[model samples]
Target: MSRMNRFLYSLADGLKGILRNLMMSLMSFSMLIGSLLVVGSLSLLVVNIDAIIQDLGDQNEIMVYVHEEYDDSEFNQISQAIMEAEHVVGFTFVSRETALEEMKNDLEEYASILEGMEQDNPLRDGFRIQVDDPANVEAVVTAMEGVDGIGNVEARTDVVESFLKTRNAVNLISIGLMVLLAGISTFIIMNTIKMSAYTRREEIAIMRMVGATKGTIRLSFVTEAMIICLCGSIVSFFAIMFLYQELIEKAFSSTGLLQAVPFQEVWGGVLLIFVGASLVIGVLGSLLSINKYLKV
Candidate 1:
């Protein structure tokens, strides 16, 4: 037979094998879908948590208040010192006059009550400093405190630290769960293929007696397993996406307390992961079963 004809014949045999062992195949399919859903859900959770942490970091900044006695040249020196500080990406100086004006505008309903306070502005001159990374904010704050003429330095160190800790904990937990699920899925798939091979032992033996090559036998079994896994992966992908969109609409959209990373931004990568994992698991499971049960 021609190579193309042989390939087609093997694929046909694979489909027959699946039908011949419909119950076993369905069990494997169901287990695979469940595993993929759990893995995908964990992955999405980690992705959204990382996104939230990044947004928080971007919005965080340090406020450095300078002594009221400092004149323009002294303030200029202080600004220069702040810019030169470690982890300081940039800084903007806000004079007491500008601060008072901003306060009045923010409290517009009571603007008249503060109309005569410009000459005795209670606000102090300060710099709003941006750091290179949220993780380094404490370092930047420490560096700011050491700068001459700077009276006080303020930062949201507690919030940043809490977010960082949460990110690390989620990553570790996700990794552990994925590994456990993959192992369980692989084991169940292996047993399903093994049972299929055992049921067709007579047929496999006859083919071997007729001079069938080991590769040909292996291909049919591998193809059968892969087809099963591929179906599960595709179904799981769409199911998770639908459930994720529903969650975003019903829960995340109505609240400003939490924000989710859009599914569109991550679906491509998630699909690739699912498909790739399915193929690998399918091949691995089939080979192990065939080698031990059929001795192919």
Candidate 2:
């Protein structure tokens, strides 16, 4: 028989063996799903949140201020110099009128304090420059200094740095949790598979005496493990979909942090994690358990 056929036949036979212990298999599958859901959910949450944070960081562009009395020719020269900078991604000019409008929108509480001060608007007009990377912000800032018509460059360095630090800390904690949960999941699945093997020890011995190859025996157990794991993964996916839509989406949309987190992207990431986790747990646990039985 072809290798493919052999694999299918072995898998089919394994399914039959598992079916003979239907109640036990169902119970094991349930446990696998629960363990994987815990691990996969946390992994998905971390990855999605990290992506959102990165998007926010990417939008952290530098705002370069210009002197109020600076000439138009000097302003154009400075704009051109910023555009030609090595690390410059994009630059947008905020005219005096635009700056005043922005200030008005932000400071509605102090409307009376500046209700009629059109000519007294002290905010400087400037170019908002975006760099290729947050790390290269200092390079961009240094390049902007002393450029004609530019008063000073402000990068919001402290705020962006704090955001990066928080992102890294969150990612680190999530990674630690994922590793711990993965270890626990492997332990549980292995024990469950071992129990299955123990329960079928006599049957396995009988098959061995009847000239069953180790490959066949191993494949059968592995098939059982795969089934259990796949079922658990499917359950976790639906559960996450429901929870994400009903709980996370509904709650966050009301608060307007919804745009900060893209729902579909997060869902896709979570689905991948859930499926990948299921496969790893199912295959690894089966291999470990079947190897022990093969020695006997």
Highest TM-score model number: 1
Q: List pairs with backbone clashes in candidate 1.
A: none
Distance (Å) between predicted and true CA of 292, model 2? 2.9
Give TM-scores for every candidate, taking all chains together and pairing residue i with residue i. 0.90, 0.80
Superposed Cα deviation of residue 266, candidate 2 (Å): 3.9
The true-versus-predicted C-alpha distance at residue 12 of model 1, in Å, is 2.2
Residues 1-296, candidate 2: write the lDDT tens digits. 67788688767866775777677677667766676666665565556556655665588688898887877788779878998997898989998789888888889998777676687777788998888766577778888885877897888777656656766776787678667766666666677677778877887888788888887777767777787777778887888677767776677578876442555767677777777877887788778767777765
- Relative to the true structure, how large is the alpha-carbon lDDT of every model? 0.86, 0.74
Q: Name the best candidate (by lDDT).
A: 1
Judge candidate 1 against the unseen true structure and give its global Cα lDDT, from 0 to 1.
Answer: 0.86
TM-score between model 1 and native? 0.90
User: What are the per-model C-alpha RMSD values against the true structure?
Assistant: 2.3, 3.5
